[model samples]
Target: MSLRTLTLSLLLTLLAFGPLSAAIGVPVTPATTESATATEAAALEAAREYTASLKSMTAKERRTLKREQRRAVKDALENHQDASTNTILLVILAVLLPPVAVLVYEGELNNKFWIALLLTLLFYLPGLIYALLVIFGNM
Candidate 1:
């Protein structure tokens, strides 16, 4: 097989296998998951601190605080949520061209893009729904 075909096949195979492997109870140790849980706890603590700090600001301070919060939220969503696409720009693109939204959200021309594009061509609603789901981590 050609390289592209082989790679695509492998990707699809792994995609198909992942949920089944999880359902079948693949063996895994707890050490790696423990570190991940620790990081989540730290992040949760930071969020709590942020919310508490917001409660004591003056009106002008609250306006500045909101702008800062917006910047931080946008940065976090861009880097982690939507694969580094500029948040406002990505939302506009998502509204105008849904498949392109999927491409940007994934940061690659991957399976999700192809699937969204195909669905879009076949029917706009399904494509839009799938793109939204993927973008929002619902699917």
Candidate 2:
């Protein structure tokens, strides 16, 4: 494989598994070792296939591919950021107004919002708990 492919493969491998592996302090076993090897092999193979396809494409096609990839990555990042902000806002709203939080999280005045409103009206704690569960459950 070319240098670009190799670099991309290594970056992907790290991005895919590095954080989880570092965060989890589980001891390595035969099963874990086998799975790790399989994952690495799959990543390498995917990178090779991607690079091979790129090699066969014309310069214009490559430029278009790169542009599309960049746009996709940017959109994904923006979506993630929006989700984080929404979650934070929802958490605050859940504490202050459980029904409103549910409505915002659900993006509509539906059954969930009605349930939350009822719960909040009947008892504050239950409403808060339900709102938190609904917000965090989907995550």
Candidate 3:
């Protein structure tokens, strides 16, 4: 084939496949806000149905159900307790060490350590939002 003809054919091929390549690479975004709202509504409906079912059950049956759920959770925790404990410790160390290091490095032991400890505890509840406000002031 002629050089010009070969170059033109390759350009057209690339142009045709470029969008296909992009489509293949693009990750699928989760459902939009409206779909998320619908999903939450469905979950609420399911919870209401489950609660209504529980109300119809006898006290003995309810107690048995609770016992079974507790047993299952206990068993699962026991099986994975080592890994779970390690993960929890690692996360605590990660979140705590940075602030403590900063406090010690700056030699603000009295004020900074107490504030960092308080912020770290609060972070366990409301998380980064509380930390951000405490450390950096409100955005």
Candidate 4:
């Protein structure tokens, strides 16, 4: 998944779990706003509780979770995969240097990346848009 997609999925997950609310910048549906706020508070409390319990975890479980997270992040950064994995940093990178992002996703400065780079060199807008598409697997 693209970083953009990953970030959005994470945001939605947080929203659904009540870990986010308008107070954080994104607005929730009016019908769910109250629920969201309540959920957010609960989520915070749960997180705090988990933090307190962290030391109680078996070392293997913690290592497994860490490994999984690392693998997911690595896959997201290197592959223009699915399941919506957009991250803020990836979005910023895409915006600031689209060609480089394309190269990273493509794993080389290959044809697609070159095209993106050329477009970027020729015109910023086309380059940026093309890079976004490429990184998101549209290309």
Worst 10 residues of 1 by lDDT: 82-91
Give the whole-model CA lDDT for all candidates, comma-separated: 0.75, 0.82, 0.58, 0.74
The candidate that wins on lDDT is 2
Model 3 agreement with the true structure over 17-130: per-residue lDDT tens digits: 656758479876878999999999999999999899899999999999999999999998888746445434433333445354335334566665566567656643333233
Worst ten in a row by lDDT for model 4: 81-90
Per-candidate TM equals 0.37, 0.51, 0.37, 0.40
Candidate 4 local Cα displacement, residue 121, angstroms: 0.7
* Between candidates 3 and 4, the lDDT winner: 4
- How many angstroms is residue 39 displaced in model 1 relative to the true structure, after the best TM-score fit? 30
Model 2 ranges off by over 4 Å: 1-58, 74-79
Among all candidates shown, the one with the greatest TM-score? 2
Give lDDT tens digits, candidate 4, residues 1-139.
9765665576446545653454477855465788889999999999999877777889998888789989999998998645334444454576778888877777776899889989989977788788878766653
User: What is the lDDT for 83 in model 4?
Assistant: 37
Q: Write the residue-wise lDDT of candidate 1 on 81-115 in tens digits.
A: 54344644654565557799989878899999999
TM-score (C-alpha, index-matched) for candidate 3? 0.37
Q: Counting only residues 3 or more apart in sequence or on different chains, how many pairs clash (N, Cα, C under 3 Å) in candidate 2?
A: 0
Q: Model 1 segments beyond 4 Å from truth? A: 1-85
Off by over 4 Å in 3: 1-30, 81-139
lDDT of 4 at 54: 71
